[model samples]
Every structure is written in C-alpha cells, then in structure tokens.
Target chain A: MKIIVLVKYVPDIEAGYQFNSARRLDRGGDGLLNQLDEYPLEQARRLAEQFGAEVVALTLGPDEAEEAVRRALQMGADSGVHVCDAAVEGSDALATALILAAAIRRLGGADLILCGAGSADATTSLIPVQLAARLQIPALTGAASLTVQDGAVEIRRDLDAWSLQLAAPLPALVSVNDKTGEPAYPSAKAVMLARKKPVESLDLADIGVDPAAVGAGGAKVEVASITPAPARAGGQILDSESDDVVAAFVALLQANALI
Target chain B: MSDILTLLDDPAREAERLAFAGAIGRPVGVRLAGGPELAARPGTVAAALATLAVERDAAAVLLPQGLFGAEVAALLALRLGAAAITDVVAIDPDLTATKPIMAGTAFSRARVTGGLAIFTVQPGLEAPPLAEPAEVVELAPPAAAAGEDRVAVLGLTPRAASGGRPDLLSAEIIVSAGRGTGGDLGPVEQLADALGAAVGASRAAVDAGWVDPSLQVGQTGKTVSPRLYVAAGISGAIQHQAGMRGAGLIVAVNEDPEAPIFEIADLGIVGDLGEVLPAAAAAVRAL
Candidate 1:
C-alpha cells in the first residue's frame, strides 16, 4: 500500500508575531509545521509501519517550507516532496487544492491520502474534501480512529451526538482529527537519518500547473483587513459587602438561562 | 448584492440563526417544527419551502452541513433547479462564486454552474454575520395538518452540567489556568469573575485534576479564538497553543521567564500567578 500525508508549515502559534510594514507576517525566521498536521503525519507513519507500506509527505508552500517536509522525513516518512514556488503564495483554499491535486497526480497517485481535519493558522478545514472531489474519491472527515483491512478503510467519525463507523473502498481520502493519538516526537537517530533521505523539489512548471490556477487570481474571498478584535470589558468582582456585584452576576447568568 | 436565504428549525434556531447570519444576510423566514400535532400535519419544511418560493423569491438556499440540513438543502436545490455546493465556508462576490474545500485547510473556487447554487456552510468556521432589522413577514401555519414526517418528539430532555459559563467557542474573553494554580480553583475563579471571562484549563492541568475535563482547551479538546486570553502557569504546548493561537491578545503570568507561554504572549509577567492575577484583577477593577 502507498499513502500520502499532506502537511502544512504554519507560523508557530506561540511566537509573538508582528506584521512588517507590508501588513504580512514576518517570516524571515523559522516557523514550525502546523501542530494539527502532526497528527496526520504520525498516523500515516504508524499505518505505513504496520502495513509495510510506503509513506510520502507532501507539502505546498514557499521554498522555506522545505523545513516542514524535512521534519516529516525525520518522523519516519519514506521520502518528501516540496511543491515550492512563489506562485503558491497568497493562494486561497481553491488554488491550494488545485496545486495539491496536480502534485498528487504527478506523484503517480496513491492508495490513500491523509490530512489533518484543519490547519491551525487558517482553520478553514476545507482541503481534504475538495481534494477528494477533484480526484473523484470518497472523503471522510472528523475521523477519530481509522483502520485498513481487506482493501477497505474503516473509520469512526465523531459526530455531534454519536460516533459513526463507516467503511470506504481503497483510493479514498481521510481527514484525521487529533483524537486518533498524540503525535510522536522524532528520535535523534531518525533526525540524523532524515538528512540522507531524498527530498524532491517540484516547481509549478514541473507539475504542469497553470499559473492562473494559483495565487491571488484564484482566490474567491478577499481579506478586506486584518485588525485586532474588539477588547473585552472587565467585570466587577462581588465582595461580601457588595450586593450590586453579586446581583449583577446572578442576573447575567439567569438571563442567559445558565443558572 | 445577491441575496442568500437560510431556513431555520426553531429547536435548533439559535445555532441555525448564528450559522445563517454568519454566512449571508438576515434570514428571510423562521419556521417552527416538532409540535404535538406535527406527526399528523404537514411538515414545517413544506411551509418553509413555500415561503421561500412565494415571498422571498429566494435566489438561492443555504444550509449547514449535517444529516437533516444536508438532505433538505439537496432536495430544495434539486427542486429549484439550483446548483448544489456542499460544505462551503464563504461565498464570493457576485454570489455566483463558491469556495468550499476540506474543513478549510485548502479551498477551491467554483462558480455555480447552474442558476441558484445552493450551498451549506460548515459551522464554527465562519463567524455569524452581523444582524440587520428586516421586515419579517410571517405566514399562517400550514393547513395540511402535521403527520407528514414520522419523526416524533419522544421527550425533550435538556442535558445537565450546563452551568459552565459561555462555551469557549463563543466566549470573548477566556481565563485559562495551568499547573501553577496549585489545585486551588478559588483564585482562578476570582480572576475569571474580575474579567467576566470564561474559565478554561490546559490539558495538563485537567489531567492533574485541577480542573474539569470540560474546561480543557487544546488540540484534543475545544478550539477557542477568544478576543482576549490570559494564561496563568501554563507552559504553552504546541497542542494547547493550536486551540487558542487565534486569540487577539494573549497575556501570560508565569514564575518562569522561559515558559513557552511567554513566547506567544503580548504581555508577559514573570511572577507567581497567585500574586499577579489578584493584582491584575484589582487593577482592572480600579480602571
């Protein structure tokens, strides 16, 4: 079996980011792979190890995003592919999917493609389904646990009220949530070995990607602005002597029917 | 502007309203369902459809992605000769464009190949759009009498454990405590009280039994994007940060200056949370 794990490089959420004069994130320094993406990477690695399958980590971003692919390799991916090009920048969800679909096709396709339910930065959570649609495959999302056997993939999905177990044929897309398991940390030995592994860099031209299908022109929604959210007003703490504070708190709760 | 109409089931009205308003303009009609005679009478869905057909003359219909709404939207789209787009987050300008992909990690631009594209937006991804006063024209109850759908209301029993402030998803301010709270929830509550913030706990603190599991925030728990988030004694973990990283302002109070929480915090205080929180609360009150 062959599996492809889609990964993304995101700004470290814990990093205090300041927008440069261009109103974009300052990315000259290092940023880590999106924390959510790790779950899928680990799940892919474990599945590959269990089935003796080949696992490939694929990422689409700027050239600097190679760090994310390297990290995936260090974590046990058999090889890595970087779909790097300036044309990929500022691409909205649609453009990104088109590029990824093109790359997946170029890679000779796979028996399965796994992705995190959502990325930390955008949290759009729309990639996997769109990719499945483009590839004409069944896509299951919000999967808490997944297993492969007898040429079919069984998955348990977390719904609002109950868990649903469904099975799909091979050559399907599955978006795994972090509930699957905690992502494993790479060992020192794996990190050292990752350097020797091959990471193929593919440009938009190499993948036969049309420039118009990516970047700003392909984006549907325009970000009017990115401003700070409104500030929250502090509340008064009720003291033993202050009936007003106590009354206000109780009234607020009652009004919302939370009492 | 192209108008978008959203249908509502009164029982899920709040969520439906938020979902609709978050996606398009003010919803045109509000339909009530699950009455005592509903089983014997015409379904409210028919009435809602009629209202959309006659009054709103809705160009398109939208619903959230789920079992009931998905079925309804698909049926309505087919009936109206509208193109169907499922699991969409945002509609582009001209109303003819749609961008729906996987939970939103990637997007694909698609135009309504046919007229009146019906789409469903995923909940929790897009914020509800602002409300505007629209002249609501209520229709008389459907005369067909209720028993069309056999789905019965066996008994409506609300869940307990509902007293924990606003959900982290909708809360504007969150006061999250970590291991440094010393298993004493008093000070954390006091701080939450001062700021009118919802109480949240890190997975580590929750695992330590310092807080309830329901209050845990992280990749494994709830994702929150509050306007202001205050972390006390929590050394930011990548998993935890994934949940609250979208917060507008982050303030960290930790005894260790090297704590990872400080790295993301806009304001950092290297001191005991027990001391710092009380002082900060008092200062906020004074202001």
Candidate 2:
C-alpha cells in the first residue's frame, strides 16, 4: 500500500513577507516547509509505519521546493517527487490543484492522500477538496484525527460549533488539522538516510500539463490591489486600579446596553 | 449591483444570511434547499444551491460562512464555471471583495475575473439595512452532482466537553482567557458569570487544555463581533486578533505591558490577571 503526502515550501510565516510585481507572495524569499503541512506529514508517516505502507512526498515549487521534499524524507517518507516548473509559479489554488492532481496521476495513484488544513502562506484551504474533485475521489476535510480500517478512513472533523465523524472510502483525501501530533524531529542518523531517498524532479512537460494553462494567465482570482492592514490605533490604558477603572468599565457596558 | 440570493437549509441560519444581505443594502432572494422544514445534508444542499443559482439568474450568491461553505462554493463554481471567495468581510458597491489572509496581517481587495460571484459572509456583520420580503425557491439537486457517494457523515461526537458550550457568535458579551490564566479557567468563568458573558479561550489556552476547544476564539476557531470583549492573559497573536477584532469594545488584562493584545484594546490593564479579574468581577457584581 502507498500514501501520498502534499508538501509546500512557503514563506516563513513567522517572519515578515515580501511581495512581487504581481502582488503575490515572493517565492524568492526565505522559506521552509509550511508549518501546517507538518501535521499531515507526521500523520502519514505514522500510518505508513503501522501498515508497513510506502509514503511518497510530493511538492510543486521552484528550486528551494526540493528542501520541502527532503524534510519529508527525514521524517520517514520512502521517496520524494518535486513538481518543479517555471510556469508553476504564481498559480492560484485552482491551477495549483490541477497541477498537483496531474502529478498524483503520474505517480500511478495513491491509497490515501493527506494535506494540511491550510497553508501558512495562502491560508485559502481550497486545494484539498479541489484536488479530490480533479482526482474523482472523496474528501474528508478538516480532520482532527483520522484512522483507516477496512479500506475506509474515518475522521474526527472539528468545526467551530460541533465536530463531525466522517467516513470515506480508500483512494480518498483527508486534510488533517495541526492537532494531529507533534512532528517527529529528524535525528542526525535519519537526516543522513534522507540523502539516498530517491528525490525525482519533474516539470510541466514531464507531467503532461500545458505550460500556458497555469501561472498568472490561468489564475482564477486576480489581485486588483494589496495594502497592508491598517495599524491599530493606540487605545486608552488603565494600569492603575483606581475606583475609576471599575466604574468606567461598568459605565461603558451600561452605555452600550451590554449589562 | 447584483440581485442577491442567499442559501438556507437550516432555517436558523436564514436570519444571519439575510442580515448579511441587508448589511450590504441589497434586495435579496432565498433558496431554501430541501425546504424550511427539511434537515438537509451538505452535499444535497450544495447541489440545491447550484441549481438555484442558475434558476434565479443570480449575480451573486451569499452563503452563511461555515466550515462547509467554501468546499461547496468551490465545487458549485467549478460546476457552473463561476467564481467563489470565502471569508468575504465586505463587498463594495462596485462588487469588489475585501478579505484578510495570513491570519489578518494583510487585507486584499479582489475582484472575481468571471461572472456570477459566490461569497461566504463572516458572522456578526454590522448595521443591517431594512430587509425586503424575499422570494423563496426550492430545488431538486441533480442526481450526479449531489456528492453523497463521495463522503458519509458517520455521526457527531463531543470532544471532552465540560458542559453546554456558549454560542460565541451571538453572544453580546464575551470574557476570553489566554495562556496567562495559568491553566485554570475558574477566574475567567467567574468573571463571565459576573458580566453574564460567554466564556472564550485563545488558541494558546485551548492548546494548553485549560478550556474546551469549542470555546476557542481565533482565526481557526471562530470569528465573533460582540458588544464587549474582555481578553485576559492572551498574548494577542495575529491569529487570535482575527476572531475578536470586530468587537465593539475590547479590554485587555495582562501582566506584560508589551503584549500585542493591548494595541487594539480600547482599555488596557497591565498587571496580574489573577488579582485584577476577581476584583473587577466583584466590582461588577457590586455595581
């Protein structure tokens, strides 16, 4: 059995970001495998270990994207596939999903496909279901915990108000939440083993995707403009615990008819 | 401006979506998927929406933003060859969209390249205009697009819940605790009781297991716009700010003066929350 994990190298979300002429995130900036992607990677590794299944890590990016696949190998993937192409740059979630689904098809197929709830960069959370659509497979998204049994996967999907336990057959996709588990840190020995993990690089031509069909031209949504979020104005400070503080708070509440 | 169509399967959500339409000053029509009386699944309901969007010739369809909204919207857009955007905070008169990304660090104004825009509205939008009587349509979803075969909902189970969780979306007053609560929600709950407010937790507190995950307030948890919000011991991460930034009034209580939560807070109290919170709750009760 084999599982495919989707990995993305995104701008370091913890640091400030740089934008390009297209107003999209600059891929040239410093990046790492998206922090959210770690959840799905870790969960897929666990599933692979238990069932003795093979796990493949797939990513689409520029030259640095290879680092993302390398990270997965250190974490315990069997091999890696990098869908690197110049035209793949600046693709929206829709176009990106199309490229990824095509790559997955080129890999033959997958018993299970796993990804994060959303990427730290885009935060769109659109590709999981979109990839499932293009693959003609079922998708159980926002899964807090997932277990496979009898060729079907059951997931605890957490929502704002309630949680749903959903089940989908094999050849399905599930986007795991960050709560899946703490990622297994790569040991020095494991890091050494990752060097021989067979990292294959493919381009649009290799995957049979039309170069003209992606990138800026094929993106569904266009950024008309991007402006930094307005800085929050300084508000009144109440450091001293005077009688005035409590009275003021209650007064404001009453004024708003909140009390 | 486009004629608005809102989707409703749960009658309870109709008002919220209608309020969104009213907030944007648009005359609206409603597509009741599976009728007002029927309890509809997400898949069938999604198909119903797809059918209704074309039947009514809608310019834009407003969906009540929830966990399932974007997936359904995207699928429907793909089927109809339209456009979809989630977490649409506002729509201009010219029909441009303003949405936040990267946990609210940046806001992008976008316009769908294609026609027939589908948008998901956030909770607690402000200043609803007068709502006109809306026409309702019922749809029988196409057999192939119903998507029932793709995934099945086995059941719903509670996640180590302590009690009946508060509905933070509609709560008028919310008292949220952060990691600084020292892993105990007692003082926060006590303050919430004093103010008749809902109990909320930051992602830090939720991840720490000090409060119920359902009580989490953040980008990933829930977005709320209450009349009054009190943040106790939260660090004010960009993620948490995305949820409560819409509140009418924000008060922050933390030991650190440099906590980011104080930046947007209307009132800042820099001190020990353990002492300040109980004393303030006692004061509120006295008032």
Candidate 3:
C-alpha cells in the first residue's frame, strides 16, 4: 500500500507573532512545521510500518519548507516531496489544496491520504475536506481514532457529547485530531539517518501548475486590515480592604448575574 | 456585490457581513440564517442553503466557527464551485490567509480555489468590520429535507462548571490559577467575581484536582481566545501558552520575575495573585 501525508510549516505559537512593517506576520525568523501536521505524519509512519507500505511526506511552501520535509524524514517517513515556489506563499487554503491535489495526482496518487484536522496558527480546519473534494474522494474530518483493514477504514469521531464510529472505503482522506496521542519524538539515530534519505524537490512549473492559480493573485478573498482587538475594559471590583472582598465581589457578581 | 450574498439569522448578521465586505473589497449581500428558533432547528440546514441560493445568489458563503458544519461547508463549497477554508485566523491583503498548523506551532498561507469561496473565521481574531447596512432580503425557508444527514444538535447545555465558574473556552475574561495560587482557588475566584471573569485552572492545578478538568487551559485541554486572559500563580509553559496565546490581552501575575508568562504578557504584576488580584479588583471597582 502507498500513503501520502501532507505537512505545512507554520509560525511557532510560543514565540508570539507580530506584524512586520509591511503588516505581514514576521515569521519570527524561522517557521516550524504546523504542530497538528505531526499527527498525520506519525499516523502515516505507523501505517507504513504496520503494512510494510511506502509513506511519502509532501509539503508546499517556499524553499525553506524543506526543513519540514526533513523533519518528517527524521520521524521515519520513507521519502519526501517538496513543492516549492515563490508564488506558493500567500496562497489561500483552496489554492494550496489545488497545488497539493495536483502534486498528489502527479505522484500517481495513493491508497490513503492523511492530514492534521487543523493547523494551530490559522486554525482553518478545511484542507482535508477541500482536498478530498478536489480529488473526488471521500473525506472525514476530526477522526479521533482510526484503524484500517481489508481495504476499509474504521474511525471514531467525537461529536461534542457522543462518540461515533464510521466506516469508509480505501483511497479516502482522514483528518486526525489529538485524540490519537502525541506523535513520537524522533530518535537521534533517525535524525542522523534522515540526512541520507531521499527528498525530491519540485517547482510549480514542474507540477504543471499555473503560477496564477496558486498565489496571492489567485485568492478570492482579501483582508483589508488588521488591528489589535479592542481592549476589554476591566469590570468594576468592590472594596479591596478585607475578607469582605469576596462578599463584595459576590454582590457585584449577583448584580451582573455572573454568580 | 451582485455575486455575493450574506447569510445570517438576525440584524447583528449585518455586522458579520459588513466585516467580510470590508475585508473582501466586494459588495455584500445578506441572507438570514433564519429566526433564533429556526436557526437551531434541525431542519433549517436546507432552508438556509436554499435561501442562500435564491435571495442572495450567493455562489459561496462564509461562516464563523461553531455556527456551521464542516460537512455543510464542504457540500456548499462543492455546490458553488468554491473552496471551504475553516478556522481562518488571519487574511492577507491579497486574500491569502495565514492559519495555524500543527497545534499552534506554525502558520501557512493559503488561497481558495474556483471562483467562489467559503470560510469560517476563527473567533476573536479580528473585530467584525462594520459597514453601512446593505439590503437584507428575507426568503421563505426551504423544504426541510435539505437538512437531512447534516449534523443534529442534540441539546444546548450550559458549559460544565469549573469550581462554580463558566467554561474557560467560553469565558470572556479568565482569571487563571496556577501553582502560584498554592492550591487554593478561593483567592482566584474572589478576584474573578470582582471582575466578572471566569475562573480557569492551569493543567498543573487541574491535575492536582484543585480545579476541574473543564477549567484546564493548555495543549491537552481547552483552547481559549478570550478578550482578556489573566494568568496568576502559574508559570508559563509552552503547552499552556498554546491554549491562550490567541488571547487579545494577557495579564500575568507572578512573584518570579523570570517566569515565561511575562514574555507574552501585556501587563505583568510582580506580586502574588493572592495579593495582586484583590488590589486590582479594588482598583477596577473604584474607577
């Protein structure tokens, strides 16, 4: 069996993000792979190891995005493909999906495709479904757990109050959530070996992509501006001098119906 | 714009549509998602879509998180020859979006395909851009069958209690207790009451059962992007930051000057939460 995992490079959340003078995210010098993408990467690696299948990690970004592919290789992926082009930056979720769909098709497709339910930065959980739409495949989002056997996939999804088990045929797309557990850390040996693994780099033209179809120029929505959220004015506090602060606070709470 | 129509349930829907119009640089249309009762009705899905199609000629639609279903978004995107981008945190001038990847480790820029686009914006990322009222056309609800196989809202229960406080995820202002609270949430709750804020617990505090799991804020727990997030008695952890980093204003109260929370905080109170919260609460009330 063959599997493909999609990975993305994102801003490191811990570092905090700021707009540059140009009003774009500063990128904080270096961007890390979207944290959620790890789940799909790990899931793909496990499936490959279990079924003795080939797993490929694919990413779309600038040349710098190879770091993400390298990290995936270090995590035990068989190989990787990097779709890098200057135009790829500033692509919206749809354009990105098209680029990925094109690349996956060019690679002769796969038996299964996996993605993180959503990335941390944008939190747009739409890719897996959108990609599946583009590829004309069945897609499931927010799978908490999954098992594959006999060319079928069974999944457990959490729907706020209840757990649902769903079954789908192969060649499907599944977006995994954190219910799968943390992705294993790469071993030092794997990191060392990753350097020796094969990673193929491809450009937009090489994938038969129209540069106009996948970048800022192609996006249908635009952001007019962004400003700091309006400050939340602190609510009134009662007398502070004594244990009655609690009582006063409670009184205020009652007045506001918060208690 | 003749090509775009907005779908909403009420007058406030105008705010959301205007916000999108301001962002998208296009004329906007408004379609009521229906009345309060009709909006949440299980059979409203098809009606909502049909209204979108008829009144607005809405090729595609954008919804905020929690208001729409992923399945519906996908179906609508396909139906309109559009792409769906859920959880959009930020959009660039050219309409490219920067969304979180991994859990919150990085961000990627993406664009939607086809002529139409559907997106669900992440809450609190930006204020809805307000515009002058656009024409709002009310259409009859579509047939009920359009909602079949769509998500069903079983019930609307109040968020779980977190030591008598609202769910941290839904809290507008959170007063979080960490190890610095010394296992006592009394002071934190006292301060929270004073400020009309919800009480939240760090993973450490929750694991210790000093607070409920519903109050836990971190990678393993609820992610909150409140307008104001106040962290007290807790040292910042990368995991904890993941849940609250999107908060608009982060206020940290800690005795230790080197606590990591200070790095991301807009205001740092260099004292114990026990001592500082009471004082801050008093100050706020006096004003």
Candidate 4:
C-alpha cells in the first residue's frame, strides 16, 4: 500500500508575523513545518512502520517548503516531493488544490492521501475538500481517530453536538486533527539520514499547470483591505489578594446577570 | 446581480442568516433538513445545492457555519466554478467579505474577483431579525451520480444536549483555563458548573493533555462568542484572544499583573487560580 501525506511550511506564528504590501502574509521569515501537519505525517509514518505502506511526503510552497519534506523524511517517510514555482506564490485554496491534485496524479496516485485538518497560516481547512473535489475522491476531515483496512478508511469525527464514525473506500483523502498523537522527535541519526533521501522537485509547468491559471492573476478572491482590530480597552483590575475579593467579583458577575 | 441563496441547516438561525444575506443581495433561503445519513454525504448535498443555485441563478450561496459547512461549500463552489469563503463575519453591499486573520489580531476584507460567492456566515451578528419570515423552500439531497465517491456513516453518538453542560459553540458563558492550571482543570470545571458555562482550555493546557481538544479555545481550536467569558490562569495569547474577542463581556483571573488577557478583559483579578476559581465558584453557588 502507498500513502501520500501533504504538508505545509508556515511561519512561526509565535515569532511574530506581518502582512506584506499586497495584504499577503509575509512568508519571508523563519519557518517550520506547520505543527498541525505533523499529526498526519506521524500517522503516515506509523502506517509505514506497521503495515509496510510506502509513505511519500509531498509539499507545495516556496523553496523554504522543502524543509517540510525533509522533516517528514526524518520522521520515516520513504521519499519526498516538493512543488515550488514562482507562479504559484499567491494561489488561493482553489488554485493550490488544482496544483496539488495534478502533482498527486503525476506521482501515479496513492491508496490514501492525508493532510492536517488545516494549515496554521491560512486556517481555512478547505484544501482537503477542494483536493477531493478536484481529484474526485472522498474527503474525511477533522478526524480524531483513523483506521485503514479492507480497502476502506474509517474515522471518528468529533463535532459540536455529535461524534460521527464515517467510512470511505480506498483512494480517499483524510485530514486529521491533533488527537492522533504527539509526533516523535527525529533522532540525530535519522536527521543525518534524511539528508540522503531523494526529494523530487517540480514546478507549475512540470505539474502540467499553466502559469496564467495560478498566482495572483488567477486568484478568485481579491483582498480589498486589511486592518488591525481596534485595541480593546483594559477595564478595572482588582487585587484578589485583598480581603472580600471574592465578594467583589461575585457582585460584578451578579450585576451582569452572569452568575 | 442575482439572488443570494442561503442554505439553512438549522432553522433557529434563519433570521440572522437571511439578514446577513439580504445585505449582499436578495435573500432566497433554502432549508436543508437532511438526516444523519444524508448529512454524512457532503458530495451529494453539494451537488443538490449546486443544482438549486443554477436553477435559481444565484450569484452567491450562504451556508451556516459548522462542521459540514466548509466542506459542502467547497464542493458546491467547485461544482459551480465559484469562489468560497468560510467563517465570514461581515459582508458589504458590494459583496466584500470580512473575516478574522492572524488569529483575530487583524481583519481581511476580500471580494470575489470573478464568478459566484459561496460563504459560511458566522452566527450571532448584530443584524436585526427580519420583521417577517422569509419564504423558505425545503432542499433534499439528490441521489449521488454514478461512479461518484461517497462516504458512509458507520455509526454516530449524539452528544446529550439538555442533560449535559452546553456545548462550547453555543454556550452563553464560558470558563476557560490555561497553563497556570498546572494540568488540573478541577477548579475550572467547578466554576463552569456553578455558572452553567462551558469549559474551555488554552492551547498550552490542551497540548499538556490537561483538557480535551474539543474544549480548547484558540485560533486552532473553536471560536466562541459568549455573553460572558471568564478566563482563569490564562495569559491570553493573541491566538487565545481571537477565539473569545467576540464575547460581549470578559472577566480574567491571573496571578501575573501584566498578562495580556487583562488588556481585553472587562474585569480582572490578580490572584492564584487555585484560590480564586474555587472561591468564585463557591461565591456563585451561595448567591
């Protein structure tokens, strides 16, 4: 069996980020594999270790995104693929999915395709569905737990009001959340070995995508404006160390009818 | 310009959704009352909605914000060859949709450069309800086309609605904890119980395995807009603030004097949560 895990390289949000003049997130900064994608990557690695599935880590981003594939290799992926092209810089969810689906097809398809629930940078969570639409496959998203057997994949999804168990036939896509497990840290030997792993790089043309059909020119959504939200004013802060503090707090809640 | 089609999965939110859609264009509400089996098949649902949109010449589609909203919206967008937006908080007459970005520190106002607009509107906007009920037509999930990929519902476990605490998404009041809890949510749950509020946790607490991932309140978790939010032991990172900033009233308790949560909180107390949360819960109970 073969599994393809899609990964993304996102700016370290904790490192502080800024929007560029085009209202796009400035990707020029220290970056790392999106923490969310690690969950799916870990799942792929587990499948490779236990079921002898061939794990291929794939990414679509700038040159910096190659790091995501390298990290996946250290985590036990058998190979890596990075689709980097200048024309794909400003692609939105739809355009991104078009490119990724083409890349997956170029790689001869897979029995299973996995991705994180959402990218930390975009937070749209649209890619899994978009890719499924473009590729004509079943999409199972936000899976808390996942299992594969008998040419079918099943997952438990925790929604706001219900927990649903869903199943789909093989050649499907699944996006998992953080509940999967903590990703194993790469050992020094694994990290050194990852450098020797072959990573195939491709561009828009290589993926059979027209340059005019992607990037800013082909983006369906246009940013009109971006502004910082008005700062909320700090209200009264009381010293709970003082006597009658609990009473004072309770009175406030009572006044608001919140208690 | 054409009519905006609003997909109503929950009738209780009809007025707000219609009002929001009405601002963009003429509102044509389509009520979708699919059962669990149909709801599990987003592709079939999207196909049906796409057909409806075309038959009605819809310039845009509005869907309820929920678990199925984004996926169905994406599929519908793909079918219609339109642009899709989710978690929309505002829309201008010109159809510019505004949503939170960078974890709610900023807002991104965007418009479809071409074709149709598909959106999942966040609930609880300040828009006034329609004075009269709009016409709502029931929509049924169409049969899946031949050779189309479909998902099967193997099983389902409905969360107890009334007998348990309110779900985090719809809770009017929320009591959230953070790293300061020291991996203990006991006091947090107590306060939540006394106030009938849902319990939430910061990413730090959730990462530390102190709380369920469903109970996490942050950028990567669930966004909530409650009537009142009481945050305990949380320093209020930018991501955490994103989830609760829409709340009407916010109260924070932290030992640190300069915790960022106090910046946006309407009321704050500086003290150890170990002492403060239990005391607050006890006081509320006595009241």
Prediction RMSDs, each to the true structure: 9.7, 3.3, 7.6, 2.8
**Inter-residue clash pairs, candidate 4:** none
Highest-scoring model, DockQ: 4
lDDT (10s digit) by residue, model 4, range A1-259: 9999999989877677888889888776778898788999889888778789999999998888898899899988889999999898888888899999999999999999999977666677777888977887888888889999899999998765578899989899998888877889989999999999999999888889999988998888899888886768989888876756688778778788875
DockQ of 2: 0.53
The whole-model lDDT of each prediction reads 0.64, 0.77, 0.65, 0.83
**Residue-wise C-alpha lDDT for candidate 3, range B1-287, written one tens digit per residue:** 44444455335345655566456544455454343323222224434564455564554455545323444565565445566666567655445665544345445556654465565555444445555555555556554333232323333334333445554555778999998888977777877877778888787887676876556777656667886788888898877876787776777777787787877776666665777677667655664
lDDT of 1 at A126: 49
Residues B1-287, model 2: lDDT tens digits:
45677766456566666666665545464554332112113444556676666776767877766557777776766667666778878887556888877667678888777777877777666546454655555555434343357577677654565354456777888999998998877888888888878999898888887877778888667778788899999989877897888777898888888999999988888877888788779988987
Candidate 1 chain B: 10-residue stretch with minimal lDDT? B145-154
What share of the reference contacts is kept in model 4? 0.72
Candidate 1, position B271, lDDT: 67
Which ranges in model 3 have alpha carbons more than 4 Å from their true place? A11-29, A159-162, A223-259, B1-51, B59-62, B66-75, B82-164, B167-172, B177-196, B201-228, B233-250, B264-287
Instruction: State the lDDT at B110 in candidate 1.
Output: 53
Q: Against the true structure, what is model 3's DockQ? A: 0.10
Which model scores highest in lDDT? 4
Chain B TM for prediction 1? 0.58
Once fitted onto the true fold, the runs of candidate 4 whose alpha carbons sit more than 4 angstroms away are A232-239, A242-244, A247-259, B145-149, B160-167, B178-186, B193-196, B203-214, B235-239, B255-268, B282-287
Tens digit of per-residue lDDT, candidate 3, span A114-134: 888666555555566668767
What's the distance in Å from true for residue B221, model 2? 1.1
Instruction: Give each prediction's DockQ, rounded to 2 decimals.
Output: 0.05, 0.53, 0.10, 0.60
The digit string of per-residue lDDT tens for model 1 on A119-184 reads 655555546655765676666566678888888777765433334565667888788876677878
Superposed Cα deviation of residue A132, candidate 2 (Å): 0.5
